[model samples]
Target chain A: MIDHFALSQAFGLLFASFEPWLWVVPGLLIGLIFGSIPGLQISMAMAVFLPVTFGMDFLQAMLFLTSIFTGGAYGGGVTAILMNIPGSSSSIATAFDGYPMARQGKHNEALGLGLAASVVGAFVGYVLLLLLINPLAALVLKVGPMEMVVVVLWGLTLIATLNDSSLSKGLLAGFFGLMLSQIGMSTTGVMRTSVGNPHLLDGISVVPAMIGIFAASELLRLRGSAYLVQDEAQRDIAFSRILRGVGETFRYPGVLVRGSLIGAVIGAIPGVGSSVANLVSYGEARRTSRTPEIFGKGAPEGVIAAESANSSSEGGSMTALLALGIPGGAATAVLLAAFSFHNIVGGPSFIRNQTEVVYSIILGNLGQVLLLAVIGLLMLRVLGMVVRVPLAYLVPSVLAMCAWGGYGITGTVAGPLTVAAFAALGWLMRRNDYPVAATVIGLLLGRMMEGELVRTLQISNGQPFNYLFERPMALALFVFMLMVLVGAPLLKALRRRKLQQAGR
Target chain B: MTTRFPATHAALLGVVLAISGFILWSAVSASTSLNNLVVVAPVAAVLGVLLPVILASALRKPAREDVGSGAWGDLLLLAGFSAFCLALTHVGFDVATFVFVWAGVVMSGGRGLWQPPLYAAVFTVVLVKGFGSLFPYPMLTLVF
Candidate 1:
């Protein structure tokens, strides 16, 4: 599985040439800007730059596209930490605590911590991917409907952990989100919740709705305020604080390792990429923390977990994309298109014949990760000044951008309308202390969960117990999910016992 | 949080219950399969009715501080964006962009009569031209 000769060739291909660098810089910039914007997306960035790579070679095109992927993945965390808004869906969990930290005048620290985690995640993900590309693809193929259902269930458990006020309320918010997500057409071609609007045939666009709930709602709530940070004295950008935040990422080795692994595995799973990986990792981090209640409030660990997982997923997604020709989500889908355009087919045959080429692409991305760190630091200093902008200017500007961004996605009035509706709904929910994050996550995973469950039912021929009995992996996954559900309290008790012994 | 809403209880419950019931009705009506009728339809009802009750119960009767004058800004937001959406489709992206941002700023209590317009024009041109050059397709075809 470990191909050293190809690795050498890959190194030679990257370090030996200067052609790929031409597009890498621009692609990264586009990714960073697009990814950091509230309503703009990484996929949209890639799609925009996709045509620019037409005349380039396979390696150049991949390098350029992957650089955008790398930059955008980290770029989202910047907005997430500074504003309560996530630049993209993958960074939603990043906002949970990052915004709270920002409220307390820790914006620089949040961005730094996010940057450090993203770099580490991208680094580890690519390194592991380089070594385990084939094995990772093999692992993805083994995942069946039952496994996907378990994954969705695992994702739902995070919702329970996110409710700050009441557990039932959290579950309710999550369930509400699930219902909201189900509004469009179902996998079975059944229209479940469109409310007679033909524009909602695809349901609400996730990014637009996210913009509404997180960005627009916050803007609405802070109507009288001048800026995001309420206190005027703490509004200035501090480089020292940002650097300290970078240094502080080392304090949570446990979060980084766990989050990165979760991201890689979830990201590699076709159709469930960074979107679920970041949220699932954040949920798990919150569930296992010594101070679980502080997660959505201002825990630096939450930002680490979410950003690390999402950034790492890029590498995990690539493992499948290069080895098995599978695009895990929107970003990788574009990558897969690049592969086809270059006449560079993927799958077993490509791996067997073009191992060196695959290695080169991986090597290129690893370098992109390193470049993103240097680039991210400089940009953070400049971008961190957004906190100083007055709300009157900031809010309306964001609103306009958000509306335009939604228009870019749906090309219809419905996109912006959906954003408006979600914004109002989210504002009401927020006012009442509802778990807005849970609602968003639930809406995201609803269709996915339903499709997987439907497939599981069809596979079992309605004999679900029998189906579970037959598959060892499914049974194991079910038990793991059960353990995840039960282990939190057990671990808490164990920690308490340890504390008692130490006190004695 | 205090409830400044005159009919906070009525409004909140009414909205949640009303939306839930509508969605449940739609799901059941559209559902032709057994899985949908048995599993999906029932789940929709529970989600609509049971959960909102849980949420409502989880909350107090509605605090006196629950609503604020800031909430009026929400209406302003809605109205501004609503007009923007319609204007972009009908008037033109450039014209709509200038108007939307200008109106949105003023509505949100932004000062400076000339500054808002200046910002809007520059933003519109930059966005239109920048995106227009990036890809092969026309980004603001309505404007051109």
Candidate 2:
């Protein structure tokens, strides 16, 4: 059923890619550094480097990008543990137990467990990618514009579940995102609300907007806080203790498996991304644990679960990207650009056509896991030193990087300005408990929804219901949306009731 | 007893009602024998207006305590920044960016005199040089 020769060829390509490991290592190192710093995200790093990657060979470019991605995922846990701040959105769940562990002088142990679990999780995800690419590609081919709209709507509804306080606020944030997305030109060639500005013709760049919202807003929020070095007591853990902690991770196989599966499923869904996966997995792990009371009070399983799930999301996201050509998240979207540059069109026909290239990506991803784990473990103390960097210096550096990234995208000042605007908006929304993820989902899916809606409308002439009821695929997607909206709340309520009864 | 209608719900409902009324009027005025805006804009408008109201109404209840005005200043600053972004296309990106960064720092309530000037100088230099190198293609200059 499988082409052994093609797989061998893919391995050869991957081995050949190692010849330029000099370039690859630096990219990985840079990604790691960016990922270790609070408020410095991989997407920002990718956006800044996007223009520079224009001249690189396909394999080299992909290796460089994937190295950044893999290393970044692993690196994000560093700050989440050592500091209360998350290095990236994906590491938010890690902060729950990571910071507590660090506070208890188990820094080395926490970091080691995180690195090991990340590697294992990534390995599992890669195996899943190799196994499922072909069948998944077939499924992806069946997705139409209407299906995409439903998917986006479903993703938006998840925000309602994500926010702890108010569903209305979350929905409002999502709608605002949808409205913001309407600022650019639509697929139907009509600009909805650009107010006659010609620069708005292309539409708002999601990268700059996201960077501003997450990174810049974070900096602004941190302005008044007193920045201090991590307590010196945290640095005293021995190597043997750390190793023992890592050994303890395998004892919790259930946590590892559950977290990885959650990561894989969430990463398979376009627009959801690893960050959401990490949070959901961490929450679920906490809920299901026998010692749920130990969850936020330095639980090693919590660190392992969050880090593994976050890292594993890369494999799942790549599977969706290579098999379907649809990017599962922002970072994967950048990878999609790299693929296009290499003339590698990823779609339902990709595995059948460019099988070797697809396999090479899988091998490269596996290579990255090995490289990051080894490097991360060996340099745990040295990497932990990043916490010493003053926020005043860190903040400016991040802002400058974000500004540079914004400028690179549109090659205009408007890009940086757009970043500033979005950053402020993001800060306010975050303050108000509005979910920024919802906005991102809305912005990402808005164009796809518009294109599908217009096409469906055109085909039906005047009857809107014809698109929903006439097409079986569309009908199925609609039903799926209904299930997501109704079922998720009911399930959540039931879980709450069960937990209450257990407490009683 | 707390009524089902919250203040946010009432506000959202009023906004939706107003939006619906405007859409209906616009649709009536714009409809023609050959083409109708009624078919295109009205349905989306009505849905957009009514859906928010219904959602707000369904979920609404009286607040126990006032939520903190945590980021109101940040919201205003963002609005101002959005305005500044609109200004950039007209005034040349360099000038607009300088003003924008400076204004943002000021509006954010930064006290240091050196901070604004320092950031402004850095931004202007980087933006001008960056734009010149990045866009080697024919520049589409915009003026207000």
Candidate 3:
């Protein structure tokens, strides 16, 4: 599995010129800034800056783009902790506990935990990429729409874990989000709930809606609070606490490693990216935790699980891009575009002839992870200042930024309109004890599930029952989902009944 | 044993079911083909069945009290957001952003007369100019 000669050549290529190293820090900084913003995505950041790489060589461009990928992965978690808003869908789970930590005046520690987990996760992902790049590429080729549907179903199980209050409310919120996702034209050329509007044909834009639901809704609730932290004294950003938080991850080495592995594997899958990986990792961490009850209630393990998985997904996603010429998501798609810009194609052939180049890219990313730890610490200090802004000023200003960002996304008023509408929905859902995160996740997965289900049906000639039997991977995943959905709860009830009988 | 009817929870449930119902109706009415209702219809049906259970569960438990300041305050903030969204196209993102910030600060209990406007102006300029340069499209602005 090890390529010593190529590895040595890779090192030579990287250090041969200081040109690539020069772009790494700047790329990471750009990614962090873009990913931290409410409406901006890491993909968008890369896309906007893709033109900048035109002047540079392929190695410089890859290093720069990958640096952004590394930085944005962690940067997305920053806002998720500082504010309730996740910088991107990938960081959604990070907000599960990170925001609660912020409210309890543990923002510095939460940021630290997230930063550390991200750094470690990315490092692990790259290491795994070095070992399993060939096998991962082969696995991606065998995955069909049936498997994609099952992957989405696995993600949907997260709604079950997300709801702390009413399970029914969580299910309702998630289904509602899925239904809302079907507003546009379907994969099969059928319109569901567009109401004859031309704009709705494209479906609700996820980012703006996400910003509305998470950021705007939380701000509405926070209208009463003077500041983000309830305690005034704890609001200060302490580097020591941040350092302590970093140290805390070593205590839960299991969660860190598990999250990293999950992220790498899931990230390698085409179409299913870090967004789903983080949720699945969070659910797994919650399920296996001794203190499962405190998951969404400011558990540091939750932060580690989420941040680790999301950051590591970058390496996993790179596997698909490098080995199969397939872009796992928008970010990788931009990377692929960058590849073509240099007249280099990504596939088995590219991996075969250019093993050293591949090693160089992976090695460059490993170095980027170290820089992220240092740069990210300073970033956390700067972004932790969001806690100091008064809610009165922060609310409308952020809301306006959401609106502007919404427009920046769709280049139309519909973006802001969706944000407004979803903000109202999110506020009502939150008020009624429903999980807005469930809805958000549902919205993210709904399109993928529907589109893939249709494809599965088409592939099976409208009879998926027989096709299900043929696809063992999909069948296995389905069984696992059932175990998670039914068996876990049934076992829990059995345990409860036995305890009651013993007490009697 | 007496159980209180959770009016608010029930109302929220009703809203959710109504939306689900609309979606279901649209999907079925538009095309009953298996492709269209493949995902949408099943989810809607599940939500329908789940609503009564949710209602029963809500009746069994005490409703969560609204922790927000008041209904009116939340509504006003939401209304302010809506107006800001609309004014972005009509007035300009800059002017709308300024008004929204000023109005939001005031609505959220900021009592200063000059401070809100000054803060709003500075924020709007910085936000508009900053994002305008960043974004590829031209932002509609009455005053730059």
Candidate 4:
């Protein structure tokens, strides 16, 4: 399982470079800036600076891109922790608890907890990537589309529990979202619901729609309140609150470890990267916690779980890129382009020939963990002031960002128009007591689910027994999901009853 | 207190069902030539289940609850942003953003009108000059 010779070669590559180290901080900063913003992404940052790396050596370019990766992974959590907005799809779950915590006037605490968990996640992922890069990539290869369906179903399961109000309303919201997700042309080349527009041919743009549903939509709801933190007591906040939040992460060692491990493993899988990892990690944390009820209502453990998983997934995603010559997600796809720019082809043979280069990237990312802590702490203080902003100012400014961000995406008025349309729709849904999160999640995963279901059906030749029973891993996961669906609430109820009896 | 009007609930559910039926029809028309009825069947099944539930909830008597914070302000805020989006198509992002955000501040029932527009001006400039110049994405620049 361990390659001593390759390990030494990896260390030698790290020691062989002092100049490449200079690019790490800059790359991390670019990534942090891009990822913290609503519309910008790590891929966008990498693509912009990719030309700058054309003149550099392979090791230098690798360090620079990896720093950006590490920084962006953590940076995505910032907005999620501070506001109800996720900077990207990956941090959507971070907003579930992180935003709630911020709403309690614990914005500094949530940011600190997110930063701490991110560092730990990245560190754990790097160590695991070093130890299990080969096996982990191979393990991900075994997870076929049926397994993906199970994974998506795991997320879908949360839709019912996500809203404690009414299961029927939540289901309706989720189903409606699912219907909307199919508005564009699908992988099999059939347009489901384009609604007579050429732009709709590509379907409702997810980023813009997401911006409207979460940020802009949420602003309308909070408009009645003066500040994000409605309580006057929570107004007098300070930077020291952040340090306390960071310290609190260590209090739940189990949550940290479990989240990191889930993140690394999920991150290693192709196509399904941090986006799914964070949601899955959050679900898992809530599933096993003693206080499962406190999860969406501002649980610190939820923040740690989501942040840690998303951060570790970066290291996990790199495993596929380095070991299998496959891009795990969009960010890794950009990194793959950078590899080609430096005349480096990544594969099993590439790893055999240039193992040291691989190690250098890992070592570089580990150092980024240290740099992130310092830079992140400073950045959090500035971002923490968002709690002070009145809802009146916050709503419009955030709306402008969303509109432009949507414009940045569609490159047209359609972007902002889409946000406006969804804002109205989302507002109505929320007012009707529906779970907007369920709707958002449904939109996020609906297309992928449909595509996978089609592929699975084709592979099995319409034979349910063949496709459903053929894959052991898929079956195991399906069974496990069923157990969770049945067992979790039952166990919680049983425990509650026992506690009630003991009191009597 | 919580209240539910059976008539209102039924009316809303009827509208939802009608819209859903239209989408389901669209979906049926869009299915591939092959055996991929995956989307259509599940959606139909869900709608089938939901039809009865919506009806049942609607036919029931009115229930009571506390009044929510639904005000005209939400509508105003949404309309303001939507208007901004519409303006961006004609006047470009820079101008539309300035007008929309400024209008948003004024309409949000905030006390000071001047400061919001000033802030909106700065935000619009940064979004245009800073983010627009760097990325390869072209911003709508038709100045009206």
Q: Score the docking of each candidate (DockQ).
A: 0.47, 0.12, 0.69, 0.51
Task: List runs of model 1 lying over 4 Å from the truth.
Answer: A494-504, B1-9, B37-39, B48-63, B131-144
Instruction: Please rank every candidate by DockQ, starting with the best.
Output: 3, 4, 1, 2
TM-score-wise, the better of 2 and 3 is 3
Angstrom error at residue B97, model 4: 0.8
User: What does candidate 1's lDDT look like per residue over A400-447, in tens digits?
Assistant: 777776676676767677777777777777776777898889888877
For A219-281, candidate 4 gives per-residue lDDT tens digits of 888877788888877865566888999999999899999999989988887888787888888
Please give the range of 10 consecutive residues that has the lowest summed lDDT in model 4 chain A.
A425-434
Report lDDT per candidate.
0.80, 0.65, 0.88, 0.80
> Best-fitting candidate, measured by TM-score?
3
The better candidate by lDDT, 1 or 2, is 1
Q: What TM-score does each of the candidates earn?
A: 0.94, 0.64, 0.96, 0.93
Q: Which candidate is the best by DockQ?
A: 3
CAPRI grade, predicted model 3: medium
Tell me the interface RMSD of model 1, in angstroms. 2.8
Q: What is the per-residue lDDT of model 2 for residues A1-504, given as tens digits with 9 covering 90 to 100?
A: 357888999888777645535456777787887677543567756766776677887777787888888878877777667754566657766866886786566777888788888888888778777877776555555665566556545544544443424666656555555555655445655434344556666667665776676566765555443332346554464667667767888989999988887777556666555756786677667655777668767898899889888887888888778877889877888988888877788776887787887787787778777887667766676866544544444444445445544655556766777688677666656554556655655555555455666666676775767666776776886885576557755887799899999999
Candidate 3 regions with alpha-carbon error over 4 angstroms: A482-504, B1-11, B59-69
Worst 10 residues of 2 chain A by lDDT: A221-230
